[model samples]
Target chain A: MDEETAKMIADKGAWLCLQPFLDDEDAIPFPEGTPQRTKQLAMVAGTENAYRLAKKHNIKTAFGTDVLFDAELAAKQGKQLAKLQRWYTPFEVLKMATFNNAQLLKFCGPRDPYPGELGVIKEGALADMILVDGNPLQNLDLIIDPTKNFVLIMKDGKIYKNTIQFK
Target chain B: MLFLYGLLGRAQETAEKNTILIINATVFDGQNEKMQEGMSILVEGNKIAKIAKTINIPQTAQVVNAQGKVLMPGLIDAHAHPMFAGISQQAGLTSQDGYLNLVAAKTAEKFLMQGFTSLREASGNSISLKCAIDQGLYLGPRIYPTGPMISQTSGHADYRPSTSIPYDPNATLSYIERSGHALIADGVPEIIKGVRSVLRMGATQVKLGAGGGVASIYDPLDVTQYTFEELKAAVDVAETWNTYVMVHAYTPKAIQTSLGPG
Candidate 1:
């Protein structure tokens, strides 16, 4: 079935999810003008290799934060990815971690049936919200360190945690 | 002071150690290596410390000559239904439910006698049977167990007559009482819930019916019961629980559709 699908698409002169193999040792190509591709890399935060490949292939990539639970390793990868021009913004990264993933899995629309003005937090939306202390928009690191910015969290009309600190 | 003196004195008085010597035996080490030529094996305490070509007899040593026997590492049967009663269940012979533990214990012993020192039981008599065997409450092979086979409704495990409702309460419990298994739910949500329940109950691997079965009245032999989305849901549940999902499949369509591109 995979081969059949691949052949059908290839016969039409279109390829989904193109993975590039390069002969050059150091150079990774920048794919032009939103190159049509998607990449799913597992153990994403565990290795910088996937990021290097993602940049080379010009594919949009998403990662779960499970890799690099080791604090030192996470910092190392964070530093390495910062040098790349195609590196994802922290908010874009968070979107990939949350909403982009939900989109890929088709989880947030009519089939999901909980649309609140297009998932970007409009008023009169079903407020299934996560409130973190610091700003996740500033850095993905804020997610792992709740004490730095997260003051409270409410979900479905319940206060699971309210860690407001008055200075 | 008296107790300490007595203990020291007792330790100083040496008792003779008994020796056991077995000669002329073929031995197979657990690591798949074999030895021949009737070497004598010596055991002191629980360990086999000495193996020699020849040993002069000590008067105190117990000697036995095994001239014609083969000794292999205890075999471990990876999958066995120890409580399955060996019944071709269609015959309807009183349903193996009577004295299930006793039967399972005996079955475990039979497995041991067949040189299986370890057994991975998929689904069986009950948790009690496995617990008994594992806790040394009974003499049987060491068993790593799954509590019951979790089945999706009207799938391969919808083991009920067409006349009854799919969730016939009496029939469901009766099946468990008889076969030690259960048919859980029908759709994706129910299937995921059932998988979670089984995993929480200590099933290391969740068994799913990806295809129809010989006994299933819901679909025919070639028909696929689970959709790709449902299979993904099941896989997600299994993944979150840190276990594997083993789907029961008999047809290519079932395997292909359920496991395609996942």
Candidate 2:
């Protein structure tokens, strides 16, 4: 997207949802030089530009891994977020994937089923949190493998996995 | 010193009656650059009641000593397709609905274990899966379902066998059409009906295919699909239902013409 278009998006209060996809993670297998393969590569190429434009234009951006129809590739969801570190700090990627993305879900408006605060860790916000085995901001790659790094997963104040050792 | 327990297993018993106190972790809080070190959080029922360095909780509360790990908001995928993300393109087109659902069900759990707490489904039929997760029959991320993507005939989502093209619109629904993966609609009336049909099936929003795409069998990357009236009709139906439309478009003509800067 051009700077003018990016500015229009911000002025209109629209969001640009982006995914960090590389060639290996293509949702479908596309052999080299095929029209589909070329198109797929071109789409991924636009991701970086859109992200940078959104930041430059102060547009609200959302993060997602649009890895579909490939369970093996889908497992690498966290890597998509971690790769964003190429364009942003770990903290920035973390925030965009969390609290910032939740803000966009609110656009569902009256159709929103899970009403109440989401995405933030604050008083009165929904208790959706994770306990990482290491500091994500310091080492974002730890997220690339959530099963090992996310020792605990809690949703709506309910603990689903708790493997932390006690003192 | 604080101690916690684990392995309540896959079935969530319900919101913990006892408050959960998580101590000794660095908190990200989802809105800051600087992480708060050595902090704690108290979850009462389903809300974070407090976050501090010291919290005096009742003896019965669940105390999780984080051991200085990172405590942050669960991840969210603003765009996802839980129902279609796992199976292969061929499997999605030919697999039985029942089998496909089971695969998607497993996919949902995998995504959750990956630390995604919420997902805004960009397309596909996940209404029943969302209901199942909500009822505690299974575990998965919160899904904001958008239902099947609507497309114009030979547009982005059209994946019918080549011989089947130009078939009578009045004929029995195609197997793929019956599968609810996508709908082939044309003109303003069909567009409105398509949008309303998905909404009837509990879609929170509607997705319209506004241009060509590579993954599908037909159309080049730059061809714009739906006309302005058909696209507007879809938007009108969604707006009347208090929702919105997300078009799958790739070019300026496809996007700007339909979804104006207004």
Measured by lDDT, the strongest candidate is 2
lDDT of 2 by residue, B30-51 (tens): 8897888888799888889898
- DockQ scores of all models, one per candidate: 0.01, 0.71
- Cα RMSD (Å) between model 2 and the true structure? 4.1
Off by over 4 Å in 2: A25-27, B1-18
Give residue A83's error in model 2 in angstroms. Answer: 1.4
What is the Cα-based lDDT of residue A49 in candidate 1? 46
lDDT of each: 0.44, 0.82
B1-262 per-residue lDDT for model 1 (tens digits): 9999998876654234434455665543322222355666554432344667787765656565555443222323334456653333342224546555565676665444332334445454345766675555765554545556556656665655556564556653555524545545667787788777766665655566676543334655556777787788877887776555555553436645555524
Docking class of 1: incorrect
**Can you list the residue pairs that collide in candidate 1?**
A132-A150, A133-A149, A133-A150, A133-A151, A134-A149, A134-A150
